[model samples]
Structure formats: structure tokens, C-alpha cells
Target: MYRYDNYDQTLVDERVTQFRDQMTRYLDGRLGEEEFRPLRLQNGLYIQKYAPMLRIAIPYGMLSSDQLRRLASIARRYDRGYGHFSTRQNLQLNWPAIETVPDILGELAEVQMHAIQTSGNCIRNTTSDQFAGIAADEVEDPRPWCELIRQWSTLHPEFAFLPRKFKIAVTGASSDRAAIQVHDIGLRLWRDDEGEVRVRVLAGGGLGRTPMIGDVVRDDLPWKHLLTYLEACVRVYNQFGRRDNKFKARIKILVKALGIEEFRRRVDAEWEHLKDGPQTLTPAAVEAAKTHFPEPERRPVSDEAIAAYEQQRQEDRALARFVTNNVTDHKVAGYKAVTLSLKRRELAPGDVTSDQMEAVADLAERFSFGEVRVTHEQNLVLSDVPVDQMVALWQALDELGMANPTVGTLNDIICCPGGDFCGLANAVSIPIAQALQERFEDLDFLYDLGPLDLNISGCMNACGHHHVGHIGILGVDKKGEEYYQVSLGGNSTDDASLGKILGPSFYREDVPDVIDKVLKVYVESRHADERFLDTYRRIGIKPFKERVYA
Candidate 1:
């Protein structure tokens, strides 16, 4: 929704030109693979298993219909006719040719999107709640703060190459939908008793070989100092974060090594000089950032219209299930936010075809004010659909195969493009996800299970956020043989917690059966109205582990 100005346009246009030349040099042997590695990474190009993967930033997961359509066009013209929405809310074209990436970048620039700061040990995308201003429980819209951070972090000279990739997430809602607890820097926005905005800052949280819930470093920081305080946090990490080993280079590792007290002390000391300096936010600047995210025009619905919506949903069980699963309450009266399920059993999670993208763009324009929001859960959301048009929208989405009515169900899995596309993956992840989805295709079984998060990662990089899923499956390689390790009781919420390993790894063929056993244990042990997560947390992992390993 934030249109590029002259400065933004010039910056992107120039970067495209520079990358094009750099790519030409690499092809002509003027630059070797090692020499061109950083350059390519800085532009969000990764040499994957089969081809180059280009990750285009969708800042804070906001996309205009025009931008979405452009992405569809680019996917069709440059790569395969589909793209994967990553957990970071970025889109990855896994089959883009290395040489043609510049052309793809050029097309993205035309739509005010780019691959900048999307990869390579720098401050990556600053994500926020998908339902930001539209959420009923929001204290403040975090998008403005997210936008401010995006502008600050993008191409930042100070943090261009941190020890490892850095991720920051902001959330305005009481619910932790953004998973701030698992980010390098997590900001929770709220208002003080006097109505002044404040932030609860969390640091050193990540998942991989080591998983952690970010510690609360700054409990009550003023919103005006958000940028400057962040500067201090990253500056500390940039200076002291591990560099000797890539695996140990995340801020979480550093935080664990130094302890939270010392990390906070060092950050406070750094902020002493940077505070009230050029980076400190002002009222005018904050207001300017807010301008980019004006609320959608809202219309009051009549009581009769509300009644009609309720009547339709009540009369049709299918419509009611879809509504209960895919629709969320909006802050505005008679409006709702609808999630377009990308987790259909027919396709991999988060993989949207070019045609699907175009269709979503059209639907967003027709129902959601020409804009879409990408959720970190790998779903697309129309954040402002009127209640009066719910039935029509549901019918259209169901027809388009975007309405599986499994928003928070077991089949709505979070998965990575594992060995199929990722060179780092030790084993395939998509197939495991597919197997689970197919096994749990019964909506009655899924709804009975209730709000299960089944996440899979090909390896420990945890791109799938598997560490926080109610049930986590991580791919492991034992002497070149593919095996899957299972973890349970993980949760990414207000009370975030990392999962515990159940036992030793299982062969790929046994993964589905193992999961079925875990679910069976849960269903048998759970009390009335208890979720899988609550049941696991209550009864501990022993029951599921026993069932799974038995």
C-alpha cells in the first residue's frame, strides 16, 4: 500500500542497473562464483539445487493488487508459473535463471517491490501482524512502525553484513500473531496509562540448532525511541555477535553466551550516544509514516444486513464452517478479514500459481479495497471484506480452490521448500507436509483435533517456524539417509515456548503413522474443549512420546 516516491524509485532503478551489470560480469567470467556470491545474495538471489531462487520483499506483508498482479506476470515470464510465500511473508521464485534475475528485479521495481535486504546476514524484512489496523484488539497499528523500520534497515550501511541473518518482527495486537518472541528483535506495541505509545522489546530469540524465546530486554520503551533503541540493539549485535562460525552467529547465540543482563547493559550504553541523535523518531516523522497506511473507507451496515449474513451462514453448514475457520473479526462494524487458504491438499503449502495470484488480485480489488495482506502462516488475507458480501466472496473463493476451510487446522501446515528446491535442506519437507494433509483431509477429524499447528522444516534453519508449531517435524540426515525428527508442545503465542524432541528420528515412511499416533494420544488424553497444545502442555510430552515411539 506504500507507493514509492521519487527517491525510492531512483534507488530501486539504480540498484537494478547495478545488478544487471554485476550479473553480466559474472556470466562473462570477469567475476568468479565466490566473488559474485555476496553481490548476488545482497540482491536476494540464491543459487539453489536446480536454479536460482529470487526472494522479493513484500514489506510487512502488504501488497497492492497491482503489485500482486505484477508478481504473477513476473512468475509467468521469468520462472515457473508459480511462487512460494515464505514464512517471512516474502515471495520466492525458485526456478528463476541466474542470468534473468536482473530482468525480474526490473519488473519488481516497476511495481515498487524489490529483493533488497531480503537475504545475506543483513537486517531482513521487518514483519508485523497481518491484520494490523483491522484487528479488534490492536493497541496501535504497527505497520507505521514496521514501515519506519523498513526504511531505516533497508541498505543500512551499519548493518549491511551482520554476523548472520537478522529478523525483526512487530506486533500491535494482544495476540502474538507475528511471532515476535522468535525474532532477533521483537517489538510489542501498546499504550501507557496516559495513552502514550510504548513498546516491549524482546531480543535473542531464534530457532535452528538452538531454539529460544526472545528475552524481554526493554519492558517499556517509548515509541519515539523505537528506531534509536533498535539501532543500539543491532549495533551491539553487529559488534559482538559471532562471526567465527555461521551456525553460531545469530543474535540468540550471542545473547545466550553473554547473558541478558550484560546484553541489556551494553545496549543501554550504546543507546546513550545514539539516543536523541539523527535516528530518534519525532512526531512529524511518525505521522508521515502513518500516512502510508490510512484506514480503508468503512461503511456502516444496517441491522438487516447483519441479520441476513447470520441467516445465510446458519442455514448452510458449509458456509458456517468456512466462516468459522477462515473469517476473523474486524475492528470496524459489519466488516471481516478473510484468509485465502493456501494449504489445500492438492498443492504444497504457500505455493500460489500465477493464475491463483491473478485471481486473488482481482478478488482483493473486488472485495478488500484493492489490497492483500500475506500472513506469516503462509496465507493471503483480504483484510476488509464487508459482511454483506461474505457469502459471495466465500462462494467465489471456494470455486477458486482457495477455500479449504482449514485456517488453523492440522492440514493448514507451515512447510518449507525443502530438498526439492533448497540446497541447504538435508531432506524433502513438502512430501511430509503433503502426507499429513492427505491423512488429515477429514474436516471432522481436524475440527475435533482443534487448532493444531503442524510445521515442517527440511533442516534446522527453521524456515518453516517448526520450533513453534504445536507439532514440529524437522528433517534430519543420518549417514545420507533421510529421517524426520518430531517435537511437541511448541507454541508461538503470547506465552511462546519451544517444542521438546519426542525421541530419535524416524524413517520418512513412518512419519505419517507417527503423527497419527501422537494425535491419537492427544485425542484420548485431552479434556473437554482442550487444544492439542493445551493438552500437551498439561499432560506433558511423555504420553505423545510413548505413543509415537511405542
Candidate 2:
């Protein structure tokens, strides 16, 4: 993980002091709520439904054990006993005292972290593949570039205020676990046949009231020109991006209004001014950022451990389920990728208690390399757990209520804290997610369904990324009645596309049955081993829609 230098430390300290004064003035009647709104938003404090919520950024979704422990401390000291991890790779404390938020920021500064850009109409946290450094197919680690953008976007004078919030994502691997296609800006790091690093830049991709699959503006941009190109793109958007209407403010809408060719031309024109500026990446700076991340040292292990692992997999069904569901293949032999489930039964998705946070920190120290990652799907990853130690790690996680092996399954729902918690929400989302979980308790059935993503949002803001789920559910309000809309065939991979609405929205109680009908259609129509998204795309939404609304 990247550590903060003196310059980083100085900036955070100064911001904390400034926000503290701002809060004091607001409370003393000098700063009106109108004047205080932007200040509080920039500090990551929102006046939510019942209390103020503070969002803390976890850059590129990476966290050191020390940082995790610090987070637990903050949760225990400043707010309630738990914090909710967001799909954007950020964390939120729902009960933080508004007056004490500046103090919280001061503590976060001590750990080289902050709440900046986590909210408001500015460039938000830049997320990436949670398995960036350790993924088998990665050409290069993406975190260095993510960190560079983090620094550049933080308090950027040109983009401090925009029509609406902008999001950017990056990934070094071929797979798109970071959901780069749906971001305002998505960068794919790849090495061409000549063995030179380049980025495939996609622009105008977003999901909200108007969901869009981003278009490629630049193919194989040189690695050193990454930041310059990004700056140019933002500069173009700043100059011409929509401001009169909030609904059409995202770059996605702009790119759609002006066709991809025209948008690309406009960005190219803007790049002429920024190509060789100070923001341009240098070889030394890239190498310096890369130095902090490296492959972990290998351990000389006994064949006995491997044999034991195989034997346990063959003999114990529960252990086998854990291994099969939670582990991904790693580049190094005898090592595996471990996903620590944040979605325990009966709990809200992506939420962790303070004690559980500390437990994960301890486990990261013991089983992995004292590092953890927050995935884009609102889960945690212990990236480098050795195969031999997997069983012990599972037992420890089980004790901490972190051993639900439901990764990429129906039970692993992506949900926003809807009407119950968020003032912006029109209807409740968490309960609907829970109802779906209860309705789909059969793990074998879910495995048979294969690779399903059920994303839900309380409103059309798409905070839960409903537009990208294989089965997307959006809450709607019709004359004081709560209803839910369903969409299908959406995906977030390299071939990412927005889902199509099936038909009329259903009442909240009827949603699960409607989903049942849709799944039944898929099961009846699917070829052998075809995934849900594949089947949906192959047969089109008509069959599913017919069955669902029949």
C-alpha cells in the first residue's frame, strides 16, 4: 500500500483545520446552510435521513492492515459500532456526530487517508480491480496510475464543481471486475505485441436515469500520456458538459448528444494544450509509485500441506464449498485468492462491524501479507492467502462471521441503503435485498443459475449499480405506493451494456415472484453451461419478458 509523504500529510492537516473552523462557524450562525452545504460535502459529511453520514475513501480499494485497524478505531470512537462499505470502494459511517466530523478527519489524516472527493459533484474515488497486483492475467499493476489520478483529482481547481458527480475506474487485467465500462472514464492497461504499456480509454459511460455503455475515445494511448489525456478529457467536459439540467449533466449524456466521433474530436483538440504539461507522467514517477507494490515472497512449503488441502476438499463438504466458492486461481502456484464475505445471512450487504473489522485486520496479518482490498462489488479480498493456510483462514473468518462463501451468487446482493437510511431514496432497498436472499436460500440452486448479479437501488441515482446487474431492480414510487422495476441482460465486463427494462414495474411484494418467473424462463431456455447473461443475450429479453409478465 502507498504511504503518505510530508506533502500529503500537510495538505490533509490543513484541510482538517479548515473544515473544523467551517463547522464552528456554521454552528455559530455565521455560515448559512446554503454556504455550508458545499463545505460539508467536500469534507464527506452528508445530512442523511436520521443523522449525518461521513464517507471515507479507500483509494483503488486497497488497504493496509494498519489502515484497517485505524478504520475500526474510527468506527468505535466516532460513530456506531459498524460502517457500511459502498459499491464505489468507499466506506460510510451512518451515525457520525456532525460536530465531531472534523475530529474524525483529523484522525483519518494520521493514517494517510481522508474523506475528500467521496461525495458531491466532483471527481469521486478512482476504483480498480480489487485483485490488481495479484491477478493472473494482469499486464501491469493498475494502482500506481490510480494513485496518480487520486492526487491529481483531489481538490482539482478546474473540476472542483461539475454538473454532477464523475467516476473513473481502471484495471490492468483482461477481466473487468472494476466495472470500468460504466464509469465516466475507464482505463484498461494492456501491453501490445511490442511489449509496450498502453491504456484503452473509454468515455461517456455511466448509469443513472440515463444509462449508457461508454464509447472508446482513445485506443492504446502511450502509458506516459495517461494523466495528460485524462486531464484533457475532463477539461473538455468542464467546458461543455451540461450544467442547466442535473439529469443530463454526466459526460455520458454529452457523449451521446454529440456522437462519439465529435466527442473524440473535441477531446483531441483539448489534449493539444495539456499533452506536455506538468501533469504528464514521467518514467521516474511511474517507477517510484510502482516501488511500493510488489509480489510477496514465496515460502518453502511441504507437500504434506498440499495433500492435506486436497484431502480436506475431498472429505469435507462445508470446507469444499468454501474453497470452491471463495477462492480464485492465483499466478503463483500453491497460492490462492481469498474473498472475505461481507454479506452474512440476515445482514445488510457490504456492512462490517468494528470488531469484525479488527478481526479482518488480524487475519490479514496472519494469513496474507498484511494487505486487504475492497472489491467493486462491495466485498473484501485477502489477495495472497496461501493454499496450505486456507483452512485455518476459513476457520478464523467463520468465527468473525466473515465466512459466507456466496461470492458471485444470488445471496451476494449489491444494494444501497434505501428509504430507511438515505433521504434521497424513494423506497426501501435493503429489505427487498433481504427478501430476495430469503427466497433464494438454496445455494445449489443459485450455483445452477450461474453467475447472476442482482443489483438494487432505492432510486434512479443508480448508487447500487442496478443498471449493470444481470438482474437489475430499481425502486419506484407511484402515487405513494412503493414499486420495483426490473431490467435484464446488463453486464459490466469488457462487453458491458446497460440492462433493458422487462415491462411494467411490480409492487415490492411481487418482485421476487417476478424474478422467479424470469429465472424459470432462463432455466428452461438455457443451453448446457451457459451463464445467465449469456443466455439472456443469446435468446434476447423477449422470452424472459414474456414469461415474467405472462
Which candidate ranks first by TM-score, i.e. highest? Answer: 1
lDDT tens string, model 2, 246-284? 998999999999999999999999899988888788999
Candidate 2 weakest lDDT stretch, 10 residues: 292-301
Q: List the residue pairs that clash in candidate 2.
A: none
Error of 1 at 357 (Å): 0.6
For every candidate in turn, the CA RMSD to the true structure comes to 0.8, 1.3
Candidates' C-alpha lDDT: 0.93, 0.90
What's the TM-score of each model vs. the native? Answer: 0.99, 0.98
Model 1: lDDT equals 0.93
* TM-score computed on alpha carbons, candidate 2: 0.98
Candidate 2 error regions (>4 Å):
302-304
